[model samples]
Target chain A: MSNVLANILGASPVMPLEKHIDVACRCAEQLAPLFAAANRGDWGAAEKAAADIEALEHEADDLKKEIRLHLPKSLFMPVPRQDLLELLLVQDRIANRARDIAGLVMIRRIQMPASIADDFLDFVDRVIDAAKQARKSVRELDELFTAGFRGAEVDLVAGMIEELDRIETDTDARQFELGKALFEIEATLNPVDAVFLHRVIELTGDVADMAERVGRRLELLLSD
Target chain B: MEAQIVYIGLAAAFGLFMAWGIGANDVANAMATSVGSKALTIKQAILVAAVFEFLGAVLAGGAVTSTIRKGIVDADLLSGSPELLVYGMLASLLAAGTWLLIASHRGWPVSTTHSIVGAIVGFAAVGIGMEAVKWDQVGTIVASWVVSPLTAGFIAFLLYQSVLWLVLQHEDPLARAKRWVPVYIFFAAFTITLVTILKGLKHVGLEISVRDSYLLAVAIATGIAAVGAYFIRQIEPDPKAEKEQHFHTVERVFGVLMVITACSMAFAHGSNDVANAIGPLAAVVSVAHTGAVSAQSALPLWVLMLGGMGIVIGLASFGRHVIATVGRKITQLTPSRGFAAELAAATTIVIASGTGLPVSTTHTLVGAVLGVGLARGIEAIDLRVVARVFVSWVVTIPAGAILAILFFFVFKSVLP
Candidate 1:
């Protein structure tokens, strides 16, 4: 019988629940490198980091399944098993989103718009900062849940969200300006480059949005 | 014994229904601003209001209810005719409920409390004499209709302006303003608690000495303000020159203050408005059981509990629509602006309740929204909708009284 099948009958697992959380954290760590590579404009490094994120996502998923299977029968589990499961899923989403952004960047192979590049970079930096806070807060979940943090983490995440919203609004205006500028140069530049540039600019906003969503979900978990 | 029990039971049931309606309708007055701002979802807002409202209701004694029943209406004239008293009580309930239902269905936000007051006036005028009603108290209630909203509007305007000037207008590098946002929030929260407890919980029947109450209020307020100031001063200035971060932080803090303010309003509302549901029932109970109206009739504990529970159920089931109408339909609300409106409305109503003045929550919130709307621009006021709501307010009382009288006569004839 497979070890998984044996474990179903209540045998001790090879990798414990703590290992799964560690694996999830590792996946989140891998994502940070991918985001860094993208920020540095290193296509090759970004592609490699994206692959690492995907592998980590798979590992995290399998661990989550194992945790779920053991949850009902296990004599003891950390916090409500549902909360841990939700935390894992939120972490997985962050990694998957990082991978998705990497894929968009690689597939388009388009140049970033100079006018909005600084704004986009600032948004990404804020997202990373929120993500780092979420990770630190989650690690101290016991303290957060037992002693009320007075929703500090939630407030922090919400602040990041408001910032993301402002950035999106600014990006919308910048995109319109860039689109008009690109249209004026339509005769000189290839139509494909223009299309790719537009997609990349839009994806940048989406990536920031996804990161903010993860921050919000993590904040909810801490507060709940 | 049987007659007394039946009257009490009837009062309990009717009071429960009225409490449910109050919970269903009035909670929106507090929560609308938060929900409109998208600071909290409709579901989250209702849940929080329901819990705090229940806490406020159960912990607080029903001094406010007694005040409404005896202080506003002359029970001396109401003595000696159980049949007429029963008829009057039933008439008022039917009148208030019918008007509220019609107004709610039409999506016009109207005051259930105001409707009840009007129905009481109508029934009292018909049953005894116009002279029997305490015009002095009635005058106070009417004045509150104007006072509450205007006070709330003025406060909201000032609060929003201060927020704009202190936080939104300031140009501080290294996000220095961001650090102070939390301190300002603490002061806002402290003031909200002090005002709410002083104005809202006074009716709860603690009977604390006035000097003691004021001292406690000041102590609580100062303590909170000091702690907030300390933390805000402690936040290390950011290395990045991100002015937007400061603005966003201020906005979020403002939103938090709004939520706390809404919570205070919900608590005070339960203490004061719970009477609208129980007043008639108590009158009915007094008449059916003792065959006389007494100034000091005590409502059964079970009836009060039932009323509180009914409120929770009503809020869970039907409160969302009212909340949406107030939260989203009236106007678009940003966090800072919504906070100002909620704080203003809460402070106004709390003060009114303390001074034994009856105010309309609907009028106060509408005025606050209008104040914010004016700040935005005249075009944002939506004058057509405002006109429709105004017309409903004008018609609500007489319409409710007529409907209640009609319903009472019909039920009386059909039941016998």
Candidate 2:
């Protein structure tokens, strides 16, 4: 009956935001299997993983759009709507970067160098860990809102963001090492293959970078 | 005598219609919070609302009914022509009931209290004379319309903030919730019980001194809280659900608190809103029975009973669908937050009912919800709906007044 009390409550974005990050992290997760398949020189398995990544990336995009559409200008929330919109953008990028990495590998048919394969897969796994950690951090959003973005909940999320930062730093270090290893064998590899491999490493590292930015966006909400 | 019977019959029918409308629409807002929070199922919410709303109307609805019956209009001015008073009240009831039906159909957020008060003020000042209205009492009623919501908001803010600090923010929130929820339960029960004792019991012909009222309230509240604690203790944490949502078990504990608040909310709604349904009927009944405007006569218990029964009938017939609709839409209000809003609004309304002030229960509730939003407890609140509520608040008075004026002239010529 057009109840005023019911209308006064705008749809809550907390659960949806949590769900979006979960999808983004799962998309980033697909990179691990995609890279592993490529490292084993199994083109068919790698393509399947790439397709999975593509599907999840599309899902994340849809979720992001849905969250934005619900978050109209009239909504009064505890955190700034701008900050949440920014956070959603950064979270979506994890899936976007995962898709980009898989797209590049599939287009170039880049075979892993024998010397760098083991280290490269490790780097990929660590980057995915960063995305997972970012999910863990953003998962605290509902609790943070419940606590009014204060007290022990803030500290708990702060601790999570700190761990997220550490994982990102670890991804950075691994990316540096993978770059150095790729350079030593660049001459033996085709010149174009060598260049694209470095590009892929950089793109892979951007996953963690986007994940780190999720933490930063959440931090902005925390500070406010 | 035949004309008096006609007036009484018309007034009863109109009052029952008004009461039924309130039961159908207004009761939903009072019960939706509990249903939305999952603290009470729809069936349970209805049953609870039925019982408590009836009790509230019968036991605590007198003061506000008296205010609406005689406080708003200056009865002395109409002593010469008591039939005019009957015509005006009959018109006010019809006007308010008609306005509510129109507003409900249009899906506008209008208050029954505002409409009735507006209707009474309209007929008295216009149909009779400008000085025939009790402007000071009207002023107080208008002031309470503003003050009740703000007061409820402030209380809700504080209550939710305390919940955050005491329970949700703790290192072990489940343990904290278990330990502290009963105390909150005690407060909720205490405030409602105390207010009802102080203000409502006298209407039932039972008066307790202030000292004994406090002691009796404390005792009753303690028993309710003890029963609440036992239920809270029985809630076992679902480890799997807890992994998915950390507050799962804690909210279950707050579920017990929400149920208590829900009852208070029903009681509060019945106490104040029954007056809107029955106030005019009481006026017409008195005038028709005595054939004189006598301020000294006591209010008959049957009028309150008739109002209570009308509301229950309304709830049975139409409130079911409205409650389900509202409950589905407000899923964001978990028990912890819903209790704060309900408790604050219930306390404010019961207090207003005690003081004989006719405040809008829906507006007070909107205020409480905004208070929760202010404390950062709610995830999202639409300021647009809130703005619309204010607009309707300002517009309802004139809409009801114009309608009442039309009905007043119609009744003057048609009625013997």
Candidate 3:
């Protein structure tokens, strides 16, 4: 029902074969707002998006169970049912990860730290851009399935990956600087909080990496 | 008849030894990628290789036994002289077996074919003078050492470059890339089927015309490619992630290619090299039973089965070590690179076999590894180890021949 819930459901069919497109549309809508909140550094809004994602995941699980129950004897399917299931699981993982990042912001309960917030903001923007590209590609899956288009997609993914790597490198440099500053102001800050912040930055980078992996897989599938 | 039985026994034992050596060394060729990718554990790899190899050898092994027994050597010279024929076969088997065991223990990958040729020469020299051995056939076999690996390496290098250009270098959007994947799959399938049916199943009496076979192979390949493409297209793309997922996909595709390559290698190897073990057995059978040499002797099904079984046992018991040496120690084999090397190696051997050239799979694979290493840069290759392997190749024939001669002479003296 909510945008967050819809994004979490992703573009996959919901069950009994008829609801898949509807669920997929819901998933896309839900994901857009989460990205927006992440961009604006609205921690409370991000937490709501995360809650929507959690609810969507529950819905997907329920859908899967229902599909299994109704189609218990149905052997023939469009594709290998297991493969479809795996695809759904992987898509759901993307939503889950996005939600987890949002939840982390809420739990930290601090205004975006002034020191590295801008850098984090920039990295998030790049990630959103990549996700947007992926969504567009998925929408045009039929046209892009040809060799000419698939070849272009592979190149695009490669470029995005390179940019992601570059941003990660920059983030690492910033983290190093922040670490030194934290040590300098050790009397004012808890060392444990610094460590936690460091972990959060690393996890954020990992989410970007997971997104790239999905891009590469899509490229291989479409191009081959 | 008594003497012929003894020779057959000796031949059977030799065949078993050859099988052991193959199981010990060649199984790695098939399972190495799976093991390296951690897709299959070492123990799992060995078990799978052993079972599939044995099944492949026994169920599909045809004409290979007869080719090995009668195709290479002149049986006329040993005609009417049962004693000489028996002695020659026994001597050849022992010599070849000894060479293989030594190579295995030392972690060398000397060809079973090369060792057998040397043993045959040694026995032929003693049985009917040096003139009885077909020097031209021997020359062809020797020439294959240089030809097989170089050809395989070159082809593999090209294939890898093409894959890189098409998949890694292309700048299409994800949807477009997904669309093209079917074409690549089609090509891969076509090539694999064409090679397998024509080369792998050649010995089996699959009475289809070559043209028809090619057509059928292409159609099947296309179907497989289309199916693969459809599934791949359904997944979403996110390019700003780590590249491990891409690597993982490459690994899976490579694994499939390697399996097909291994199957073809096994089939071709069986058809061609069955002679190393059973050639002597056939020679002994003719000498003791018919008291005359004959080139047309058909190896009984039982004898061929024995040879096949021996190979299975050898692979199960002692093949793991040799596989490890080749798979890991030869060069670091990433899935894609290893697949390229194997495809090159299989293609080279198949062409050589078709043209009746007895090329060494060992040479071809090593050459492919060298080719890949050079592509990466020679500095990355361990030249000293490669040099040692090359030197061993030069010496295998002579060493095997001399051992055969010495062993035969001793057996002759002791028996009388």
Tens-place lDDT per residue, model 3, B1-416, is 45456556666676677666666665555556456545455676666665545444443343334434544565565555547656766787888888887886776657777887787787777655787676776776677778877887787767666555555335432333355556655665576567556654655445667998799988998888666666665555445532322433444444444444444455445444555666566566655566666665545667666766766676667666645544443233544556566666656665565555555666676787666544431112434445666777888889888888888787777653
Task: Give iRMSD, candidate 1.
Answer: 26.6
lDDT by residue for model 1 (B186-254), tens: 555555555555554544455566677667777776676565556445545344622333434444545
Query: Candidate 2: which stretches are off by over 4 Å?
Result: B243-245
- The residue-by-residue lDDT of candidate 3 on A1-224, one tens digit each, is 11111111122222222233233324434544564575577766866766776676566456656655533223322233454455444444455565565566567653335655565555555555544444443433322221223354445545554554565455456556655654565555566666666665555555545545545544444333
Considering DockQ, where higher is better, how would the candidates rank from best to worst? 2, 3, 1
Error (Å) of candidate 2 at residue B172 is 1.4
Cα deviation at A40, candidate 3, in Å, is 33
lDDT of 2 by residue, B1-416 (tens): 99999999999999999999999999999999899888999899989999999988877888999999999889998899999999999999999999999998988899999999999999998999999999989999999999999999999999999999899888888889999999999999999999999999999999899999999999999999999999999999988776433588999999999999999999999999999989999999999999899887888878888898899899989998899999999987889999999999999999999999999999999999999999988999999999999999999999899999999999999999
Cα lDDT, model 2, residue A130? 92
For each of the candidates, the C-alpha root-mean-square deviation to the true structure, in angstroms, is 16.3, 1.4, 15.3
**Top-scoring candidate (TM-score):** 2
Chain A only: give the TM-score of model 1. 0.56
lDDT of 2 at B161: 93
**Native contact fraction, candidates in order:** 0.00, 0.85, 0.06
Q: Order candidates by lDDT, high to low.
A: 2, 1, 3
What shift in Å separates residue B348 of candidate 1 from its native position after superposition?
A: 0.7
